[model samples]
Target: MKVGFDGKRATQNITGLGNYSRYLIRLLTKFHPHNQFLIYAITIPPPELAISEVEYRYPGKQLIKSYWRSFGIIKNLLRDNIDLFHGLSNEIPYSLKTAGIPTVVTIHDLIFIRYPQYYSFIDRLIYKYKYRYAALHADKVIAISKQTKQDLMHYFGVNEDKIEVIYQDCDVIFHQQVTSLMKDEIKKKYQLPEKYLLNVGTIEERKNLMLIAKALLRIDNIHLVVVGRETKYTLTVKQFIKQNQLSERVHFLHNVAHCDLPAIYQHAELLIYPSRFEGFGIPIVEALHSGIPVIAAKGSCLEEAGGPGSIYIDPDDDVELAKQVKGIIDNNETKMKMVRMGKQYLDNFKSKLISDQTIHLYQNVIDNAKR
Candidate 1:
């Protein structure tokens, strides 16, 4: 059987869905060498990257249709005589179902659906239309977490069987081994405090940085070292920090190197992810696997990622959030217990296991199609 995947999100500085797309491709190639895989990418998007038996076919800009939305993708499906074409991102050509081909799509989250406030009116319309298109058209949809699967069933009325739950894995390189001295050196290199709480994600309102800043203002002992790109909303946090005289207490770091992230996780006192919503919290799992305790927001997919490994806090309540952070730091026994349970929780989320399960889904989808 021949399978094709979207080559669009494979560009540099990949994060979230882009990382998911790339990792899925890499893992599929490693685990299933006998199957023919085509990575269908466009120009500048670049394609034809191979790992062992898998081939990336970037059907250049000339062959691809000239428009941007579902129309151009429809042309690609019409042109490629493939067994199955999967749109890794959410959008799919309206014509794909009509082309007598099978397609799979992955829905990372319905953040736009849940928090329509974050998006512009025009963007909201686009999101609604595209989500409806993908939900109605795709042969099968993969949800990154059970929460996402539930969201699809609740919001879009997608058939539960058509939606398969597949959890994502952390980067293989994240579980790096660094000595105590080396970890200390990394800490000094960043000028980070000996015991600081870390947060990793794009700095945005939905990420709930304001709540975190409010909590940081209450906590006197620990510093907050945030790692993510700056946005307009981040300036709001910065302004709050200055206005509240937390100039030294609250910190921000941007454009962090992937190589440097593992050490950042390992040496830190703990990781604090208080996002209002998420498809999956990859950093929480990374911190858990690294034996670092996690403090995450209570609702949404953050709870799913935390499972039994993390301590949950309400994103809206700064007093409660700060209390939890302090509770963990003040009590060594509770901190140690969370660390051990977090490691055990991480055992279920390994990259290889996820890859095998995904392969099973692909084979089942194809075999059922054959019948």
Candidate 2:
């Protein structure tokens, strides 16, 4: 059967959801190698020729194209002899009903429900209509975490069985072994010291990067290396570092290639994640699989991802975080202990394992529709 997928986020969003789209599509291509899948995307000024394959398809483009893709586009999808459609991010046309096609949407998180102020007025408006509505209407919903699934059930009042919990897999490159020499090579390349901590992701208020800076300021002979694009919120962190005279110690790495990340992970003495919230914590798995010890905030998804042996701290308590950072750095025995625990947790999230399960879920969704 020919499958239709939303590829709009592929070109638009560069961060979380876009990565999710790109990676999920890649996995689908591998596991369901024989099945024909068409990727549906919106473009301004349609391509002269449409690209078609078992993996992806670019149907049309532009405002007229979007309108057509939503309404008139169904005619083309029907013409393609498609059997089912899956909306990866959100905001399905709603017109899919017109074509008698079943639609599936994956709900990543519902931070908006708890902290609506974090979102702009228009963002909240769009989420209510495009995302929340799609979750309620879709034939099936894929939640990235059990926490997210629970959020969907309580806030949107959806059936539990309609939503499936599918934790995302780590990057294919992140593994439990990079040689000592390789770690040294990255150190030399980046001018990194032997003992330093690593933390990655957006530098925003919700991410609580300020807490990380506070934690690092108290620890002696240790530096924090941050990797991610700079945003307006980073100004506070930059200003804090300067005021505290830690400009020399705290380093900011903006826009590093994903390929070179494993070395950085290996270079770290430990990986610290103090995010106030998340749908799922990817870095914990990356650090665990990279054989690096993870230190993160308590009472969040980090606890679930880190399991045991990870150093958990109250994110708001700078004094406790400092104490943990010092203890973790000073003790080699502690680091080795956490590394062993992480290895066991890494097995369940192996890409091949989760990808196969996802494929099975897709097949189940298709099979149930027939009945």
Query: lDDT scores for all predictions?
Result: 0.79, 0.77
Compared with the true structure, model 2 gives a TM-score of 0.91
Give each model a TM-score.
0.92, 0.91
Q: In model 1, what is the error at residue 321, expressed in angstroms?
A: 1.2
Candidate 2 per-residue C-alpha lDDT over 1-371 given as tens digits, one digit per residue, 9 for 90 to 100: 56787777765666688777767776777777687777777742123222333344445544476675556657767888877787888667677765677778888888876678788988888787777888887888898888888888998898998898887877677864677887777777777766788988877777788998887777888888988777788999999999999898888886676767899998788898988778888888888878889888876567767777788888798888888877777888887888988888777676777778777777777787778
* Cα RMSD, each candidate: 2.5, 3.1
For each of the candidates, give the backbone clash count: 0, 4
lDDT score at residue 93, model 2, on the 0-100 scale? 66
For model 1, residues 117-200, the per-residue Cα lDDT tens digits are 899989989987887789768888989888889999999999999998888878777766767886787777777777788899
